[model samples]
Target: MHMHVALCAVLDPSEMPGGYRFEAIENLVLSRLDRLPPFTRRLVMDPLGLDHPHWIEDPEFDPIHHIRRVSCPAPGGSHELGRLVGRITSRPLPRDRPLWELWVVEGLAEGRFAIVAKVHHSAVDGMMGAGLMVNLFGMTREPAPEAPPPREEEHPVPPEPRPSDIEMLKSAARKRLAQPRKLVDLAKRTVERVGGVVERRRDPELAHGGTPLTAPRTRLNRPIGPQRDVGFARLSLAELKAIKAAVEGAKLNDVLLAVVGGALRRYLAHHDDLPEVPLVATCPIATGAGRGNNNVAAMFVPIATHLAEPEARLEAIQAATRGAKEEHAVLGKGELLQDWADLAPTTTFSVASSLYSRLKLSKHHRPVHNLIVSNVPGPPMPVYLAGAELEAAYPMGPILDGAALNVTVMSYRGQVDFGFMVARDVVPDVWRLADAVAPAFRELRDAVLGAPSEASPERSTPAE
Candidate 1:
């Protein structure tokens, strides 16, 4: 069985009751659920069923394991968490059943709850995960606990195959030949996808983000890391839309990134540095068009808040972003990742990621991107499944050696939530980054609405 290759570095330290421990939080989340929903929970609790601290032996295994109740002593809170996550996520999943794990974390600044859950990329995609959150959530603080569903049917494990050298050669050749056909198929898909978005604007269900397609390069858009430092910012979507309306042709997404640009600009200016060139952001284009895995790819676009006026910043983002969509039209993601895979094998990729772990590292390698910025869509309406009301949602992403930061945002019914993950060594004050993002939004709102920024967008470069 192929372990779904997902690197959902599974860490987000949330503020909670100081006295609450890791197990308590896990139990709390677990208790909030109505019943142990058969098919899914069985998958989640498989490792626990075998009762092994390490379930590496199970042939039909669950790739994700959630360890809990960990602490960070003085001199290392976020750093320690970052280390722990890096160590856990960098290894290859054992050749077992399902892949994934959920860890309950403790010892954060505000007595927060940290969830480090990962799944094999193959088993669950991003939107599915987002969708699951709704069902998993409770509607109210004191939700009515529902009855649990019957347990799923369990079966015996199967044997694994040991391939010979000749078989491996044949497999490789076969996979290689399949590529040409895949490419041809992708070309046909390219036309179909183009028709879906632009020509088919009738399909409002299309998943989209604010920034444009053809963004300019920024100093920040460099190769990135396996270790990440994460932070979050929450805002009102209504207010954002109001600002978008105020500014002519200002899309809400453009306003969002312009706000980030303004914040990045200010953050950089404080350090007395600014890039002569604009920054580039690699945003995701969701391809859950009922296709196979990784139905997403990055759209490299420009961040222009560095320009003199907020209006110019928004316009720059729009122009550059539109161009980007046109280009992404022809670029199929399946082929792109194959090119990426050739550059980084799964094992070496796993080992290289080890450097980002709590352990030590070598100095010779570079990461794939400078930073990761993702914006995921959420239900416009509130949803409930288990019991507990879905209070809030935040997106988390992986970090590596070179790229110290990842910023992922998820917009729920009424609020837009932002999550920033960084390397503890690099961004010591993740909360401070949170502070930066909020004001960035306000500045862009004023600019979009023809209001004055509390402060102008300062000029700055990516962290040195």
Candidate 2:
């Protein structure tokens, strides 16, 4: 999917040492950009489609052009904020400047505020995006004293100038010269990987990974529009840990997958569209060894959404993920995915994607997978941005043509925040899906630790 990512951070100004003001927070966010390279760079594409685009320093970069302030609508709750975010993310970032934006949102409930940071998928993956935001924050509410100005000869290196068309063509020619050899290697590796998978299939104990074009069709597997519907859910990390501990050999990720599977099962059943077969989810794993800002590979897992019982689903997910990990280890870390990506020209992808969307080709073919579920690790301790106390954090991933729903979960200060981004037409009443997360958690918890003496109430999204 060609898409951008947005992370919403709800802030409490009451905890700010110097009190809250929009100008002060905006200025504080702007002051941190001097050290981030992606903020100051613009993408320069080859006019003749000879090679991939290049990131060059923008000589006319202006911080104000990228960051702006917006007031939430009436009620100033989760629904209002989600609508505002959906509108903000639906529009594409301008290609003429840096592929990023920061919106300082005011008028949230209780005198609080929010910071919505948007960055293109080309600029950062889940891990890299989280790191970029962490750079702007501090360990405490009190801002650390600024470092002294650099003395003579201590200045940073100068930014590179934009290259001319002739220079770019020459570079592309040089790169193309080595393509034949790399292409040969890519083919050999591809054959070997296929052979390995075939051999693995011979072993009865070794489970096979998910295959493309095999997923069951559903309402989510269709073409999507520019409009998006957003939903937020907050879960207790402690509860998740307890659930994980209940099942032998189950990881925290497996628990998360189980919760999502249960929720999807209920949602589909509610609509009377639940399929007999289990649903497939494309889980992204960060390799930390790939090229460019997005250094991640995908692993397809069969989420047991077809199962009726939550505990049974958790066990099934645990087994499936174990097999997936073993398969990934055998396949190696993203080398095959990267090599294939490198062999394709930038223009080919851009053109193919455009045609696919324009022609609505996805509706005529088998869906790659049902949806995308990403798990991003975040700060364990309470961190402050500028002077405001961080209350909630929700990160959203991009939705694809066939897979119009994306559920991205992030861990922050003992809380697991879930952000849901879906096509407006494909899935109306997104909050219905979000609201199901708590019951899913409780169902699993009750199965494991037995029903609590006192029932724990459902969790509402922050400021709702």
Candidate 3:
């Protein structure tokens, strides 16, 4: 299955007389593509699924195929952009080619445009994705040239040949024969890990935290359809930092969790579907260092949605996240999830995945978590692309079978951009939830920085 992750960044008009033309943008993207890391040009798996998949260069690679131009409908505002993004993301990337694409969107108001870049999760994680953005863009509008002069007789390198099905089957049989020893080793590690987790949970300080399979069901936790809805909101990073500094032991992430918790509470209440227990969010933490992809771990964070007061909710979230971090630490920093994933037979996994999706098993079982909330740190310095300033960047994550909502925040130069991805069938009114994010943050801000005076206009208005 193709699990595509995408991010759209709105950019100021390029420093050209008539704004950027399709040909100029396309040429710029092609020039940068030549310098992209080798991994970005490869795809996973082979024609037959008899062996483990690995990345290989595409012999028939074409920059034009992956990069193109599109225009929004009339009135060309954020709503039009969101609808276009939703439509672009609904379809899966073609498996016959490289699993990434970039679209140069036009026809927006204020002489602005947007770039939507989509890459498969199997290729890059949050950290790698951020690094890719930095590499593609520049710190200044007029960046110095770094590439060497092109040769007139350059030839495309041929990709390595794939293994035959017979050879793959033979190798699989040998691996299966050796599973007895692998299973014994896996069992020992599993026991040790489970023991450590159990011991950590025994601490009275951490015992109250939510665990796997304990998340409360909400409208967001349901089987999702192929259709998606995208919404966006922006927050002042400066204000968030100020609020974090004011609150004791509060970090930016903690504040974000609390704000999202508040928004979810209001949204569910509006639909008369608020759960009695606090909602849980699966937070994906990047474990990779520089340039590595797919290196991430997760922790279940209690959003404290049940708490009515903003301060109370923030405090509860701080405590819950603290415990969750402690538990994750006890579990060790090893890639335990990836280690186990290596044991799954590819054929079996493919079959199981197909059946699970076809049967709609997500609706029958209790959700593991209500939703996914992730925060990816971006460059604090200004970033420019093709001589255009990056005004804001909002990342959209893939929705799973049970978890139908994904909220991702990317902190850019001086602002935080939020992207809400929801299943269209489950929550078509996702814009309402996105709109609530700013007000929720304002509530937390008021609680931290005493209520504003009645005469002040800022007290009544929420930050945009």
TM-score of 2: 0.95
Off by over 4 Å in 1: 1-64, 67-97, 105-116, 120-125, 138-173, 177-227, 332-369, 383-386, 400-402, 451-464
TM match of model 1 to true structure: 0.63
Candidate with more favorable, higher TM-score: 2 or 3:
2
Q: Who is ahead in lDDT, 2 or 3? A: 2
Candidate 2, residues 1-464, lDDT tens digits: the string is 43899998898888676677666765665566665668878888777978888998776776667888899997789988888888788888898998899998989998878988889998889999889878877787865334323332111225588899889889898889999998998898888876787788689987766766788999888898888878899988887887888778999999999999988988888888899998999999998775888999988888999998889988888888877777776677677888787778888988898889889999887889999999999999988976788988999989989888999999998889999999887887788888889888888888877874243355667767
- Best-performing candidate as measured by lDDT: 2
Candidate 1 C-alpha lDDT tens digits along 239-260:
7777778767767777777777
Assess each prediction's global lDDT (C-alpha) against the native: 0.51, 0.83, 0.77
- Pitting candidate 1 against candidate 2, the one with the higher TM-score is 2
Each model's backbone clash number: 59, 0, 0
C-alpha TM-scores of all predictions: 0.63, 0.95, 0.91
Q: TM-score: which candidate is best?
A: 2
- Per-residue lDDT tens digits of candidate 3, residues 402-459? 8889999999877888889888888889888988887888888888888632332321
